[model samples]
Target: MVSSSPQTLILSRILTQNEAQPEAEAVLVEAGRVVAVGRREDMQAQFPKADTLDHRDLILTPGLCDAHIHLVAYGFSLTQLQLYGARSVAEIAARVGQRAANTPIGTWIQGGGFLMSELGLNDYPTAEMLDSVSLHHPVLLYSRDLHLAWANSLALRLAGVNENTPDPLSGRIVRPLGTLLENAAELVARAVPAPSGAQTLAAARAGANDLAARGYVSAHTMAYEGPEAPRALQTLAAQGELPLRIWACLPHQRLPEAAELLKTNSELFEFGGLKFFADGALGSRTAWLHPPGFADGSGTGIALDSPELIAALGREALELGLVPVTHAIGDRANTEVLNVYDGLRALARQKGLRLRVEHAQHLRPGDIPRFAGLTVSAQPIHLQGDAAMIGALLPQHQRTSYAFKSFKAAGALLAFGSDAPVARPDVRASFAAAVTRVADNGVRLAPNEALSVEETLWAFTRGPALAAGWTDEGMIQAGARAAFTLWDQVGHQARALVF
Candidate 1:
């Protein structure tokens, strides 16, 4: 019931990404593959007995694909406390207090999506703020960027993260025992109870259904989750319950394990890349930068994986026939990853693989051209929230922050995603952010960087397909996969209309 894979005729105004044949009035599908696309009259004449559905008023395009997401985590977040638009710390505390009031004592209350700046905080938030409301129950709230975590005193105590605890490499246990940055967050997260197998499966289902409802037929799930997360997706695929195609990555630390498992490319589930982090995020004040770091005088941010380590692991990943997908958000991070990539380019090309950089959020003008021929998995929706932050913390890098136009002009495949849980995976917001270059505060950040509507659409569709090496997807053409999204208008309401 998730897919109408039988022979069918879909009549609509189709916008195929194919430059050779851009527009069509109908599409014919058989066994989940597009058999023909042409004027409605011709399709009807050719397949007179095929079942037909009239959608002449709808605009049909290739199914939307979120190029980056923590699918299971996003699903779990749907039920968690939403702190996305909280205007003040007091508001977040109130929500935590309310959740604690209904739950049993000693249970952990988990939620995220708050920005320190949005909360009007000049310094790092402390456990005391959350303690004022939920002292008996442990509470952990993540920043909007997902790179930092704020924990109540009880949560800190349970995690044994005291002032004496030393910072882990590339991670920080912020002073006064409240905030954890980068890998240090794991110190507290590891103490939290893990979701059961059934819970994981439910979360997976919720994520897939949510994306499907939002017109996404495929997702590239970034590796920030447990092994069980992918297993749940695999289970769903096995049961024919999965509604979206999944392309997953293994954390760099799991390289040995991934090699042992030897996951290969599949239409429904693919383990195609090895993921790495060159640095943290901007909102967390942890995005690695060069001299004159944060405009606020916070020193150059933390560097996660060294270039040497990335190269070594990247080479191994290539041998295993997987792409090297690194998370690089700062200029220094991007530069370092690019240098490492420079060495791997030959091997990658020899292997017929496209290297990818996740975020590529902030870049040096000189480094912009280096992204040519690479996959820049960016999240335009992030610009809505990041505009103010970029202006405030990285004014020197403003011109290149979320520079979609530059990436496209440089010939980099620009794959757009929502980085959900960091930002909502809403296609409409992506279009608005890319086309308007407007922020939540109604301020436009680098308006000159705005991309055309057609360009943005390709980033959300065709670009992601190329990044995933999915030739049959991201286009509505003969012999392509019969996955489509029906939209009232390009940037308006839309829903998945897959066969």
Candidate 2:
């Protein structure tokens, strides 16, 4: 067991990332912060009676940090019905039936993790198939990307969604089984009652604990859920229940309210990022792209929020000391975001905010360097699952998809994370994907884009720390956080240890 006592400990082969090679060292922890790191002999002579734990064969490095993730939602989804491996619509229906039989009548049956392509249904599944089993309970199952949702007849009727219902702005209504895309899904989601404060807090705690178990010492939770999520995290922090440090963002729609919240409380948890969506994802064929969009002629793709809106809000956010983070998945989306970022570069520099782009997956070669001085918060693990989609829908993007090496060369700050509730936040898997560049199809997306193990570690640690504007964490050195992650080796095993 590790001691909490403000004592000195000598470790073997401490990796200072600042140094080229590992060093035989000692670390002094006091008040949960690293006080000193020096030669083992010097530390022993300086504090002979201080408690010491030697990690002879273990590598001592900074704790891992996830740059982007959804906290409470991911946790709640963990216990929900899983449809990740369902091969066909029949399989999905069977699972829904099983869940419905046990559930009380008239309640909404919610579960996720289905890919529309894998369902064997070219057309969306209507509520008829679900109504065939049990019309008593409403069902709303989300696609893997969460950009699209499939609802049963009961759920649609309850939500007042019909063939005559108009699609919400920046959203789509798939004909037949009432599939709502993007903001349209929120309509039905809004009708559902919000979770209680207790439930929200519990889910947040569960999510944090789960991430900690997976070797994460901290995270930058992208605010996609309502205000309740960050409030829940603050509650945990106040009670000393939070095991990891949290840096949270707020959606642009809630900017005014968030500004008021920040005016009163800025240090409760690091609150300094504004989240925006530049476009939808590829799964739903909503990602904005260049000419010759989607090999299947999905019609040039869908654009969500305009770059002008992001830039306008970004300027305001900077005035309040908040960084701007936008989601950009397609080549067009990335291009537009880069244009907006270019407009804010000077302002970002003035405010000391590193403008960030989430999921800058697909990119044009010429626009790559425009990301310099910006934080590229990306998911490498997404490549493993997205390989097929890239081949089918985005053949032009395959060369630059998830281009970690290219981004590094362009001087972009690379931060890696798993968009949990979208992809499992497995640190080992993320590292493997970044370092190996191998995909699910057993083919490499771009061998030139592979990152080194150390580079991957830095992205998971220091890169995210810098992106989130955190100075006291993400490093193993004096004045750094006492949090640390132990790994047997890259892609092997890991666990988080918070002092």
Candidate 3:
């Protein structure tokens, strides 16, 4: 179905994503690499000996890349019970009840994608609410943000967690013995059995192939997943089963292990970042915020990783030729990370490394200019779900929520992603949300922050390529990979084209 050798393509239009030669009517490939790009007639005449494929009816552009994703986790989530649309506790219980019927007794039943707000709850769901429906089986469901976990009594019991259980570092065992926030969620999570190697490989394949099928030729896999996750992806690549190129990271704590990994790298996979978390997600009310954190009197949110460790580890990452990437959701978190980044700027520049801030979701006006020359790896699709939440929870930061345009103006390279498993890798949703700034409730969160179609495309393409230090990707030019995405329209339906 796909060709590995050279071929010439006659296209209706090619958005090159290269500034110098931004458009071309045709491209010539050899050895699965771009050889030339020019007028259709010129390419056809010059490459007469080459086999020609006519795609003059469609538009071609650089293949899409979901700059942020949890490949293995997304694969595992494919088979999990989905609660992304459940609006009430009864509905969620019914679904969990149905799952319990199918699952054997005492076995763990896991699923997620529900929001406390969507469930019409002002607070976390209690263990009692899920106790009866779980049929004595351990049940665990995560909030849409992945920062909060709702567990049935059995799951909590299995995890040996109770009201008297002291909270884990930077995490909380919420009241009533049902909700687990941040690191505490790991307790119940660790209690669940890990998937077998076969399952891991299968999930890795599923996640990569799904992205490839959606016209994504590359992805930047975050370090949120377990070690088995990257190992599975590596196995897939070694076997030639991986269809997408991956730029992966290791947690800051994994620096010792990272050196062993960096010893070897491949075309399809590379360890390029050292990941850090400055705070948790907004949905769980765990986002480290400034004074007057949550309007509902939730207090300033919890801080996770300390700044001192980040700076110390960051320098090591830079010395090791890896990017230092930190996740900052709340304004206070962003400010703190920026401050740390400022101190590292000299060493980072000397090392020719660019610091990256993931999410950059909420920001202060003063923090905007500081993002200059940094990478803002943001997910525009988050706006649709977070718009109302931002308005309700972090009102003071509303004007700066998902500030794409502002980041760009401040000299930050914008690399857009879906943050898969946390959100669907829907390009359409990303395009629409970034350009329209419209939320699910039909409210525009920050219209002034919206990006143009071209800008959004660059964020998805060139920006990510540059962010990952892949000069040959995210553009259609001589020496670039022959990968391209055929689209019905600029941001509409898309499919990857073979050589």
Candidate 4:
């Protein structure tokens, strides 16, 4: 038996993503990169001095990568109250009351993971519901989609959000003064005290370590939080506390600042993309749809960050050697983004950069082929929750929803992720959602869109690596990173195996 060491010959049923050698029996790793991959006996004989890690009974695949996540924000949500399964507003308020009973009277309380439809609510909830329980404490809870926020009276007052306050462009202050949608949520979010630098660092560590614990070797963090978020992750990496290799993005609005770090890279972190949102999410009733809007009579949803802005800033992002990543959830939004990307593609190709679209959730059939040569960073886990909503809210678009197989057929580079904090980064959840197209409500959203297990695995691994431009990751080949995921069963129990 060989003892564990930095250099080891690991044996397993290797699913090498390299086209030349799709499978291998063994791999030789030194430092943190693969030195060679070949048959078990040949590798063992060649590297007799190298320690051996025998996992011949397990399956070894390229390292898993979450292509979209809000790392620091998700970390903070881990400690906050989780409102994932609540079926009623009263239940949510009770949970808040219990937390208030133990906390300081004036502290702000935060939580998320509730769907408007899941609660069986016919209308936007009122602040009075939360006010009844924690009158003194400011309570602010976000909808599962992160596009809608419900604030208690105190919190709304703190943010100076009143019934008469005009809604910010592309946002809504839902009447009766309790819910904030889209950018409007930021009004109250600003009032909540910021976590201290130490707390931020702790959260960064928590998120990164949590992903590592779940067998993820790397992640692409979306720019949903403040600059402090990425800074915290960088600091954690600098201190040797970060567990996952991170590809972080900055908001397109932060491109001027992003330009300074154009060529940033290190062992564990790199600034890779500029993120822009073309529209909001479905659960929040804010997906910018085409002519036929929400069936619930909620007119065509809000559009954020105009196409002009995306084109201008997106070109600028590409010039600075950054990927232009846009979040587009509706057909119209996707169409518009695709149109803008048409002009930017030439520049992106010249720079060896791939334009990326996040949450290309609902797309028109005509626009599907336009994704060729682009990265579609998506979260199938979201389908579990959005399934019923899609059927009820936008039935006309169901056929094209979560079109994973179609994306592959169209030559789009499909990458899977959990969009953590929006949903848990459970690999099985992603695998099941992609492979089955089944939703939690016992109904399949779009059966035709289901992906095969191998395709799903590719999305979770190599697809993300390609999107992030990480040539050395997401494959088991000489010169590739030695990070891998060992599985008892492909979609079952798994763990990170890094040399």
Q: How close is every model to the real structure, measured as TM-score?
A: 0.98, 0.96, 0.98, 0.98
Judged by lDDT relative to the true structure, which candidate is superior, 3 or 4? 4
Q: Which consecutive 10 residues in model 1 have the weakest lDDT in total?
A: 1-10
Q: What tens digits encode model 1's per-residue C-alpha lDDT throughout 149-262? A: 999999999999999999998899989779999999999999999999999999999999999999999999997799999889989998989999998999998898876655
Question: Which ranges of candidate 3 are over 4 A from the true structure?
Answer: none
Regions of candidate 1 where Cα sits further than 4 Å from its true position: 1-6
Where is the poorest 10-residue window by lDDT in model 4?
1-10
Give the Cα-based TM-score of candidate 1 against the true structure.
Answer: 0.98
Candidate 4 lDDT, 1-499, residue by residue in tens: 1235757888999999999999999999887889999999898888898888899899999989999999999999999989998999888988999999988999999999999899998789889889989898999999999999999999999999998899998899998989999999999999999889999888888988899899999999998788789889888888877778899898877888876765556778999999999999999999999978899898889999999999999999888899999999999999999999999999999999999999999888999999999999999999999999999999988999998898999999998999989999999888999988889899988898998888989999999999998899989999998889999988778889866
Q: Candidate 2: where are CA atoms >4 Å away? A: 1-4, 8-12, 20-24, 264-268
| lDDT score of residue 210 within candidate 4 | 91
For model 4, the superposed segments whose C-alpha errors exceed 4 Å read 1-6
Task: Please count the clashing residue pairs in each candidate, in the order shown.
Answer: 0, 1, 0, 0
Provide the lDDT at 179 for model 1.
91
- Alpha-carbon lDDT, every model: 0.91, 0.83, 0.89, 0.91
lDDT of 2 by residue, 151-207 (tens): 888888888888889988998887774688888898788777678999899899999
lDDT by residue (1-499, candidate 3, tens digit) is 2554456554569999988998999988877688999999888888887777777788899989899998889998888989997889999999999999998899888888888878888888899998888856999899888999999998888889988899999999999789999999998999999899999999999999898888888999998788989999999989988888899999888998888899767988999999999999888999998887888898778899999999999988998999999999999999999999999999888987789999999888889999999999999999998988888888898899999999999999999999989898998899999999999889998899999999999999899999998989999999998788888887888888745
Residue 279 of model 4, lDDT score: 98
